[model samples]
Target: MIYLAIGFPPAAKSCAYRMRETANNFVALGWDVTVLTIAEESWEREYGLDHTLSDAVDPRVRIVELPLAREDLATDIREFTEERALNPTRWSKQERERHLEHFPELVFGGWRSALEQGLLDIHREFPADLLLASCAPYVNLAAAWKLWEEHQVPYAIDFRDGWSVDVIGGGEAFTRDSEAGRWEEKVLAEAVAVWCVNDPIADFYRERYPRLAERVHVVRNGFDSDSVPAAHGAPNAEDGLTFGYLGSVNFKPEFLATVLDGWRAARERDPLLARSRFEIRGHIGAGASREANAHMALIRQAESDGVVFGGPVAKAEVAATYGRWDALVLMLVGGRFVTSGKVYEFMASGLPVVSAHEVDHDASAVLTGHPLWTGACGLDAAGLADSFVEAARMAVEATAEQRAEARAHANRFDRGLLMAPAARQLADTVRPALLTGSTQG
Candidate 1:
C-alpha cells in the first residue's frame, strides 16, 4: 500500500506528528509503503522542517519528494514576486480568488494536477495495491480519486479535520455547490473509509454523506511518549515562572491580541505572573509576513511583560523545551470539532494548562478531568487573566497523585497504542484487495 499525504508537515506543528505516526504505522504493518509529499525546501519556506520527526520512519518506507511547493509559505525576499511582497494581504486575497476559480481550496486547488500526475507516475512504476489519502491540502483526495477511477485501488481518507464542517465556528464551512464541496463528495464517494480526529467531525461527515455513514471512523490524535521529557514537573521558577505555547500563530490578530492582553493583565494583577515569562514557539505567517506580521509585533510588544517570541523550535527539542516550562498555555482556534494533536501531548506534560479558546472546544472535552488543567474560556483578556491565575495555583498546589492521574489520563492516547487498531483495520481492508489485484495482474 502507498499513501498520498500532502500535509505541510514537520514545520513543528500539529499535523506533522500525526502524518509521521501514520506513515510509521503503515510501515510497521509488514507492508511496503511509499509516501508522496512536497519537497524539503518547500517545508523550509512554510513551517521549517524538523528532520527529527522523520527519525522514526521505518527504513522500508520510501518517501518520494515532489518538486511541488506551497507558494504561500515562501519567506525569502529575494524569491518574492514584487506584487506579493508589496501588498501581501491584497495579493493573497487575489490568489484565493484565482484558486477558487480552479477549485474552492486556496492552497490546495493549485496542487491538484501536480499531485495527480505524481500519483499516476508512482502507480505506473510500483503498481500499488491500495491507496491512502490524508488531507488538509485536500488535493491528495483528487489524486486518490484519479488513481481509483483508473485503477480501482481501494483507498481511505484521513480527514483529520472535516472539510465541510467548520470546526472553529461549528457549522458548515462551505455550501454543497461550492467547488470544494463537489470535490469532497465525489472523492469520498468511493473511498473505502474516512478517518476523523473527533466524534463531532465524524458525525458531520456521516450527516453530510449519509450513504457513507458506515465508512467514517473516529481516530483521535494521540501523544508520542517520546516527545515528553523523562522528568515530570515544572522547572523551579525562583527566577521567573515560564509558560510555553507550541503551535502556529494562525489565529486572527484580534485573537492573538486578546491572549497577549490577557497575559499583560495577569502580569499586572499577580506578583507571580509579573515575575513570569511566556515563550511562544511556532511559525507565524509564512512568506512576507514572517516576523513582520501583527502577531509577532504583539509578542514583541509584550516583551515588557516577559513574553518571548522564540521562532519555531525543532521537533528534536520539543521535549527539552517543555522541560523548562512551568505551565502550558493552550491557545487554540475552533470549537467542538477541533481535537488538535498538541492537547494530548500537553496532557502528558504534567504541567498546568491555561486554555485560551472557545469554552465549548473539543480540547476542553479531553482536558475536563485533568488535574492541572485551567480549563477553556474564549479568548478574552479578563477570562484569560482568571485562567492564568488558576493555572498558577494548580502548578503551585498540584500533587504527585494529581500528576500521576493526569499522565494516566493521557496514557490512553499513546500514539502507537491508539493507532494500532486503526492500522489493523486498514491492513485488513487493503490486504484482501491487494492480493486479489496481484493475482489478477
Candidate 2:
C-alpha cells in the first residue's frame, strides 16, 4: 500500500517522525511504502531540516516529493510580495479566503491539481491498494478522496488534531455550511477509517459523524527510545543546573513573557534555581521576522536571568541534550484536546516537568499520575511563578524510585508497541476485502 502522507520524513515537523515510523513499520511488515510529501526545500522554509531523522527511515520505502510550499511559512524575502511584506497578517487572511474560494483548503487548497496529478502519476506506475492520508492542512483528504472516487482504492484519514473542532479555542472550527466544514464532511464520508491522536479528538469525530465512529482510532504519539539517554549520564556539575524547554516557539509573546516572569519569580525565591540556567532550543519565526521577532526579544530579555535561547538543535542532539538537563518546562498553548508530542519525550526523560499550559489540557491527562509533574494551573505570571518553585523543589527532592516510575509511565507509550497493533488493524481491515475479491474472481 502506498501511503499518501504529506508530512513524511525530514520535514522537521513533529508529525514527520510519526509518519516515518509508521512507514518503516509497514515496510517491516513486508509492504512497499511510497511516501508522498512536499519537497525538503519547502520544509526548510517552514521549520528547517534535520537529515539525521532520515537515518531511521527504512531505506526500502520510497519518498515522492511534491513541488508544493506553505507560503505562510516561507522565509525568502525575495519571494514575498511587497503587500505581504508590509502587512503579512492581513495578506495571509486574504490569501486564505482566496484559497477557500478555489478548493476549500487554506494552507494546502492550491495543491489540489498538483496532488491530483501526483496521485494519478503514482497510480499509473504502481497502482495503490490503499491510500492512508494524514492531515492538518486537510487538502490531503481531497487527494485521497480523488483516488477513492477514481480507483476505488480504500483509504484512511489520520487527523492528528480534529479538523472541525478547535482544540485551543474550544469550539466548532467552522459551521457545516462553511467551505472547510463541507469539504471535511464530504471527504470523511467516504473514508474507510479515521485516526486521531487523543481521545477528545476521536470523540469529536464520533460525535460529528456517528456512523463512522468505529473507524476513528486513537493512536497516541510515543517517544522514540533512541531519542532518550541513560539515567546514569551526568549533568553539568560546575556551571549550574540546566532547565530545558525544547519545541517550536510558536506561542504568543505575552505567553512567553509570563513564563519568563515566572522563571524570574522562581529564581528570586529559590536559591538553587536563582543560580541555575534555562536553555530553550527551537525555531522562532521564518520569512522576514527570522530572529527579529518579539519572541526572540523576550527570550533575549531573560538572558540576565540566566535564560539562554539556543535556537534549533539537530535531531542527533535530542537525547544528549535531554541527558544534560536537570529538569524540563513544558510551555504549551492549548486546552483540553491539545496533547503535544513533546510531552511523551519529556516524560520519558526522567526529569521534573513544570507545565506552562492551560489547566485542562490533554497533556495533563498523561502527566496526572506522574510524581515529579508540577501540574498545569494556568500561564499567569504569578501562578506560574509558584509552579516553577514547586517544580524546582520536586527536582531537588524527587527520589530515584520516583524518577524510575516516571520512566515506567512513559514505557506504555513506546512508538513500536502503540503503532504495531494499529498497523495490524489496518492490515486486518484491508485483507478480508482482498480475499473476497479473489474468491469472486
Candidate 3:
C-alpha cells in the first residue's frame, strides 16, 4: 500500500500520531506500507521535528520523503527572490493564486506534480495494491487520483476532517461548485472508502454525497496506549494543584484571553485555584510567528496568575507531562464536528477535566459520561471559572474508583484497537479488487 501521509512521524504535528498508527496498522495487516511525506527540514519550517515520534513507527513500513516544502514558511532571506523580498505579502498572495491554479489545494497545490511523480516512480519499482491518502495537504488526493487514473489502483482517504468542512469556523469551507469542492467531489467519487475522525464529519460527507454514504466510516482518532500514564498519581492540592493543557495553542487570541480571564477569576474565587498553576505545553504557531505569536504574549501576560507556556512536549514525555497535572484543561475550538485526539489522551490520563469550549462541541459527546469531568459550558468567563473551581474540587475529592472509571471510558479508543480493524477492513476490501485488476489487465 502507498500511504500518502504527508505529516508522518517526526513532523511533530498532532496528525502525525494518527498517520503513524495508520501506516503501522497497515503493516501489521501483512501489507508493505510506503509512507510518502516531505523532508525533515520541511517540518522544521513548520512545527519543527521530534525524532522520538519515529520510534513508534513499525520498522517494516517503508518511508519515502518528498522534496516538497511549504514555500510560504521559508524564513531564510537568501532563499527569497528579489520580487518576494521586495513585496513579501504580495508575493505570498500571488503564490497562493499560482498554487490554486494547479490543484485548488491552496498552499499545497503546487506540490501536485512532485507528489504524482513520486507515486508513479514508487509504483514502477514496487507496484502498489492500494493507496491510503491522509489529508490537510489535501494535495495527496491529487496523487491518489493520478495513480488511479494511470494504473487503476484502488484508494481510500483518511480524511481526518472532511475536506470541505470548516471544522474550526463551523460551516461549509467551499461550495460544491467551487474549485476545492469540485476536487473533493471528484476524488471522493472514485475513492473506495472515506474515513473521518468523527461521526459528525462522516455524516457531513455522507449527506453531501448521498450516493457514497455507505462508503463513509467514522474512524475516531484514538489515544496511543504508550502515551497514557500507567496510573494518575493522587492529586495533592494541600499546597497547590497544576492544571495542564497539552495540545496545539491554535485557538483565537480572544479565546485564549477568555480562558486566562476565567483562570484568573477562578483563582480569585477559589483558594485552591489561587495556589494552583496552569501549565500550557504545545506549539503556538509556525514559521516566523512560532512561540512569538499573540497567544504567547497573552500567556506571558498571565504569568502573574500562575500561567506558564512550557512549549512543545516530546511524544515520549506526554505520559510524564499528564502524570504531573492534577487536572486537564480541554480548550478546543469548533462545535459537534471537532473531536481532538487530545480529548482521548486527556481522558485516558484519569485526571479531572475542565472543558473550555462550546457546549455543543463533539468533545462534550466523548466526555459526557466521564466521572471526573467538569462539563463543557461554553467560553463564558464566569461559567468556565465555575468549571475550573469544580474541576479543582474533583481533583481533590475524586476517589480512585472514579479515576479508574474515567480511564476505562477511553479504553475503547486505544490507537491500536481503533486502527487495526480499520486497516484490515480496507485491506480486505482492496486486496480482491487489486487481484481482479491485475487479472483483467
Q: Which stretches of candidate 1 lie over 4 Å from their true place?
A: 8-13, 72-98, 233-237, 435-441
Encode model 3's per-residue lDDT on 136-186: one tens digit a residue. 788888898899899888889999988899998777999999988888899
The residue ranges of model 2 lying beyond 4 angstroms of the native Cα positions read 72-94, 232-239, 438-441
- Residue 72 CA displacement from its true place in model 2, Å: 4.2
Model-by-model lDDT, in order? 0.82, 0.84, 0.91
The residue pairs in collision within model 3 are none
| Per-model C-alpha RMSD | 2.5, 2.4, 1.3
TM-score winner: 3
Best by the lDDT measure: 3
Q: 1 or 3: which has the higher TM-score?
A: 3
Sliding window of 10 residues with minimal summed lDDT for model 2: 232-241
TM for candidate 3 is 0.98
Candidate 2 displacement at residue 436 in angstroms = 2.3
Tens-digit per-residue lDDT, 1-441, candidate 1: 778876534444567778778878878878778888888777666656787777776777788888887677666668778998899898888877776665667876877788889999999999887788888887778788888888887889998897889888889999888777888898888888899999999999999999999989999898888878664664454666888998788889999889889988988898888899899988888765777888888888888989998887777788888887878998888888987888998998888899998988899999989888887778789999999988877777788788888788888889888888998897787677566654211
